[model samples]
Target: MKNHSGHDMAGHNGHGGARPGGLSVSENGYTLEFDSTIFSAGAQTVTFRVTGPDGRPVTEYTPEHEKELHLIAVRRDTAGFQHVHPVMDEKGTWSTVVTLEPGDWRFFADIHPAGHDGTMTLGIDASVAGPYDPRPIPEATGIARIGEYTVALGGELLPGEASELTLTVSRNGRPVTDLQPYLGAYGHLVALRVGDLGYLHVHPEGAPGDGSTEPGPEVTFMAAAPSGGTYRFYLDFQHNDVVRTAEFTVRTTAVPRPDTAPGTAPGHTNHHHAHH
Candidate 1:
């Protein structure tokens, strides 16, 4: 069940047979229920809950990544991405304050019910009422800068195969060596496909205190694109006791077809179209 307001959006997560998470509002008898689908344009508190198959609010969950639930909010145009944890009340209601601009937004709840086999990602859309001017999706780039910090992305995203991607962090042209641990890892990555906002939450290659993982300079992860398309990546890393996010726009290399001629594989292309 899709849970957006009357305003219709584009894209339906067209890709390979395997469907990515966050495109549906309910899965496996669990549903994400929002109190309202409209809010004021600014910092506002939103309340929601998760209902089980019995139609009762779920109060128990298995903590993953050091949090009972992870809340991800992003505009439809792939802007204003935020990863936060909300406070759940005793009655199973969760509330969190999110800064919203005048545009359409998608909110995802990543949780593992007490008896579920694995984690499930449920998504819903809401609108911030006002005059909206959506921003175009940023071009494909490997480097992202935020507040004197530079993050360089290495490796490519291969369709239907695991590709190793490395991110090196530096500040003021110097390598950051004393990175602190956040959410039981040195970094947390969230990749969202440009069109449908298909979500992939990935962790680094190694954890802290594992004896082989260092605290600085480079963090690695293996990511696989569901299909050949453009994707937006958000990396949340901690250094100097502050958590900051670095964003990157990447396009995956298309897979070759057996019947196609040699050297006729789809090449790397940059998309400059405005997202609706």
Candidate 2:
């Protein structure tokens, strides 16, 4: 894959970081400035802008995933996930309509600013004022059902390690092999750590026209977690000329302790613990 730096990036995106992005409103001198953090309940347009290091709205941007900027918003409980592309005005202000409930919401802007060598994700918190009732994070599960479609996620997410995840799309108990291309790929995956909403946007391993990649039955992605914890994942794909998202709750696999091995020295175990 090619990174935002215009160089070959191994294992997917070249933006260098073991930890996920979108944990803050500013990074690498770029800030996501919101026009307003408070909104009324229901559907409304939210406006924002990406200010560069020069403290001016960034006008030029390198497109990623076929868009100049990708906007993601979700409630604090990982509910009401939305992946949208906002229209940017000449002044660089972006606006998109979002249906929000009475709760705290997070907005993530994933972009590559002009003159920057890597992509960055900036995040900010917003609130919809009303009577709020928070929902609990969904339980970890591999099978997710949406209407008549069933998407079964295979593979575990190992913390801080590149792990392969395969999602098989099936409808009405039949495998879907004619998946249409969306955003230049068979599927787009976004994973957010449960509590902090650390963001990771990942694409499938192969492109739509790549001879080796089939359209459906399975779409594969390589993803890494910042740490051992539960995460909420949203998979977007196109089928029957319509776009759909599948949601999943996944927990990272625990790193095994070496000291538990037979014949291991007790002194070595204590030192390892201290180092960890």
Candidate 3:
């Protein structure tokens, strides 16, 4: 039985009635459980649970991006991408089984609580038990100008390793300021790794205050690639009541880290060489 507040208000499968408190999945972190035993070669069943922050059952919460909860899963090497709708069973547990391949993958849970200012983001990395090299990042290219935005990209990302992307947006051949708010954040960036088009939803770091009346021109986004492979990036922004989009193609390469000299950090980019 689903509650009017959008929370599953029923008991099921050894689980009791709706309880208070939010669910978490990290050890030494939140209490939500991500049971992966349901995963298999072809058809897979995955179950997750959620609660409130006060240890009580979460009845009704705010919906972000038009959904109560958005779960995005993708194989580590850009093999599979699934945007799933999880059903909240009577016992307050959300479960869904998807057909998938055996490989390393990552999962992201996007949640927004009622009366909260921003959405809560969480991620988990898992392996399907196979031969995989979770190194090397992807490279991004095909940057084009869309209206007042200039977008460029590069990088290759493997599973588990953090994917760092640098997007430079400008207007009038100069850095743009006065960026307007779009999608509850400064900017909205959507990434789909090639082959399967796995989805990576991201938002900018800074946002305008609640009562500020401002507009914008240029924006930048730093996003993590969820897996290794070629990825397509779409950045959306608004100006003068019109929305603009910038597209770029990025390739992920599996290059091992070089042994730097003593006192030199790893993976550091030297901008001086590019300028010369």
Which candidate ranks first by TM-score, i.e. highest? 2
Candidate 1 is scored at a TM of 0.87
Q: How many backbone clashes does candidate 2 have?
A: 0
RMSD of each: 8.0, 6.2, 13.3
lDDT of 2 by residue, 1-276 (tens): 222222222222322225567888998899999999999999989999999999999999999879999999999999999999999999999999999999999999989997897788899999999999998888887999989999999997865445578999999999999999999998988899888998887787878877899999899887666567899999998999999999999997446434435554222233322211
Clashes of each: 0, 0, 34
> Which parts of model 1 have CA positions greater than 4 angstroms off?
1-17, 257-276
Per-residue accuracy of model 1 over 5-119 as CA lDDT, tens digit each:
1011111233221345788999889999999989998888999999999999999999988898999999999999989899999999999999999899999999988988778
Two-way TM-score contest, 1 vs 2, winner: 2
Local distance difference test, each candidate? 0.80, 0.81, 0.51
lDDT of 1 at 116: 83
After the best TM-score superposition of candidate 1, give how far the Cα of residue 211 lies from its true spot, in angstroms. 0.6
Which is the better candidate, 2 or 3, if ranked by lDDT? Answer: 2
* Residue-by-residue lDDT tens digits, candidate 3, 103-167: 77666666665665555445566656445554343444456687655755534433222334455
lDDT-better candidate, 1 vs 3: 1
Clashing pairs in 2: none
